[model samples]
Target: MKQIIEKKRTLGLLLVILGASFWGIGGTVAQRLFQQDNIAVEWLVSSRLLLAGILLIALYKITHRQASIFVIWRTKQTAFRQILFSLLGMLAVQYTYMMSIAIGNSAVATLLQYLAPLFIMAYYLLTRHSALTRQDGIAVTLTLVGTFLLLTNGSFSTLSVPFMAVFWGILSGLSLAFYSIYAVPLLQQFHSLLVVGWSMLIGGTVMSFFHQPWLIDLSTWTFSTVLYYLFIIIFGTMLAFWFYIASLRYLSPKEASLLGSLEPLTAVITSVWWLKISFGGYQFMGTLLILLMILYLTVFQKKQRER
Candidate 1:
């Protein structure tokens, strides 16, 4: 029994790490597509969500042959909620994040998205009448200082990151917060795959109407471009999500979240090395502060649970 549990935990750790790494690398891949191929963000977002959604639903069907994929839409209330989640949560998050990457480097975009937790913290404080904990305050201060340094390179006179990129990046963070918070009730009612799958499909379908990705010219795409596109949809979006969710079967949510810090770290490394994005001393310090904020919150959460 002990060995079995240990093996499961190990598997969980591997899955979560793989999942987060895939996501991190995926952002860099998407940036390459935008920079080299001039691929439209709308088309990529629609294509990725549509295909990934179909694949996930299919996987769920294969694994749980007895379960119904349509169960999430059985009631009107649920159907509405699912549609809203698909549009406002999944689609919004994806579109905004991709826009951020298109406008800036993946490293900055991803780090900005990590601000989702802080937004959630603020939301609860405002809406739920929750008291501010010391740890929360510290984490907020660290993130704010980190963000300022990242954007300004520790100088008040100039902005290191583009203003438009920062605009989209902050929006991406807010959208991510919404995505995480709004999905809770639906997640409680259905399997994560089911909820996520439907949301993706719905969001993709809606985006397809607007972008018409099928109409895009494929003749201009090189072989490598085609391969990169496939990698984004299959390995990055689909497998990343699958691995992360599967990890939850063996690890606690807090543990999984703590492991998720790897996503930004991987993004930063790949962006700096592969994309040749600059990472100056101030930016490095900013990154460390942000990461430290994440670590601090994780410890705080663990202590809160213990208490």
Candidate 2:
């Protein structure tokens, strides 16, 4: 039993790490397409969500042949909730993250999205009127200081990242907070595959009405561009979400979330090392501070739970 559990845990760790890395690298690749191939964010996002959603649903069908995929829509309440989540949570997160990458490099865009926890904390404080714990205070402080340094690059007189990128990045974090919080009940009740697949499909369908991703021009697409596009839909969107959700079977949410820091770290490394994007000293410190905030919160929460 112990050996089996250990093996499962190891598998979970690998799955999550791979998922996070794929997501991070996907951002960088999307950045390449956006800058080099001039792929519009609207078309890429809509197509990714639509195609990945179909593939994920197909995967769920193949794996759970006896299960019903339409169970989420059995109840009117659940149906409404799922549709709400599809638009507000899934679509919002996808669009904002891509916009941030379109306007800025993936490193900065990903780091900004890591601020989701801070927004989640703030949401609880506002909604529940919960008193801010000392640890929460410290985490918030670290996030604020880190964000300031990251944007300003230690110089208040100038912003290292563009104003619009920061705006979209901040929105991505906010949407991520909502996405994480709102999906909890549905995820607990249904298979992650079902929930995610439907959300993506619904969201993509809605976005298609406006963006018309099918109308996108493919006349200029080269072999590399097609490969990048496929990578984003398959490895990045589909497998990344699948692996992360599957990891939850063996690892606790806290453990998985801690491992998720690798996403931003991967983005930073790929952006700098592979993409040759500049990383200044102040930006590094800011990144460290943001990561420290996450570690501090996780450690503090664990200790509190133990006590």
Candidate 3:
């Protein structure tokens, strides 16, 4: 039984890692479409949330015959809560991340999103929950230093990327922190996929009023861009959420969040390898430092749990 429990935890960690990695790769692909093809961010975000939500809900209905999607939001209070979740948590995170990508490269955008952990740390303290440990303090410092180095390439005078990328990226990080924290109770009660699906549906419906994706010129779409859209929706948005939520079954959101450090690393690697993005020695060091945060949590936390 003990070994079985450990096995489940291991699987959970691996799933979160895989999910984050997919997110990173998907961000790179989305960056390509935005940079090369000039695909509109609003359109993709609108379409992704709408379609992915529908598909996930459909999947839930198929697999869960006895379970109805409506039950999760049946009560007025829960419905209100879910609506807020959809707007502030779901829509905010998705839109901001995509906007960040549109303004900057995938590597920078994704790494900035990893800053969610720092926000989460502050949140925990303010809520008077688990206090930050020495290790957590180290993680925070490394993340800040790493982000500065990666963004500036050790230059204090000028910014390497557009200023809006930093703005949108930081907004994405805060939204992600909010989303992850808000998701816990819902995951504990309902099907994770169902919750995610409904939230996406709600958020997409709201954003569509403003973005109007249907009005966009689809005539400009080519085979490669279409393929990229499929990947962004299917692998990136759908499967990534499914796997990440499944991992929450065996881990806290904070633990899952920490594991998500894989995202920036994967993003950096793919951006450099396929996209020909350049990085300085300082940026490389910064990237390594960020990766060390992942190693620290994975190695050190396990021992803490065992003790």
The most accurate candidate by TM-score is 3
Candidate 1 lDDT, tens digit per residue, 161-235?
A: 687887888888887677656666776688878877887788899999999879788889999999999999987
C-alpha lDDT values of all predictions? 0.76, 0.78, 0.81
Residue runs of model 3 more than 4 Å from their true location after superposition: 103-108, 144-165
Q: Per-residue lDDT of 94-129 in model 2, one digit per residue for the tens?
A: 899888877775646766776776777677778884
How far is 282's C-alpha from truth in model 3 (Å)? 3.4
lDDT of 3 by residue, 1-307 (tens): 8788788888888889888888878888888888788888898888889999999999999999988879886888777777888898888999998888777755567667878887898898999988988977886777667765765578765445799998998899899888878877777778888888988898889989998868877788899888988998988888777788778888777778777766766776787899897878987887788778767767787787788
Q: After superposition, how far is residue 284 of candidate 1 from its true place, in Å?
A: 3.2
Better of 1 and 3 by lDDT: 3
Error at 52, model 3, angstroms: 0.8
Backbone clash pairs for candidate 1 read: none
**Clash pairs (backbone) in predicted model 3:** none
Per-model TM-score versus the true fold: 0.80, 0.80, 0.89
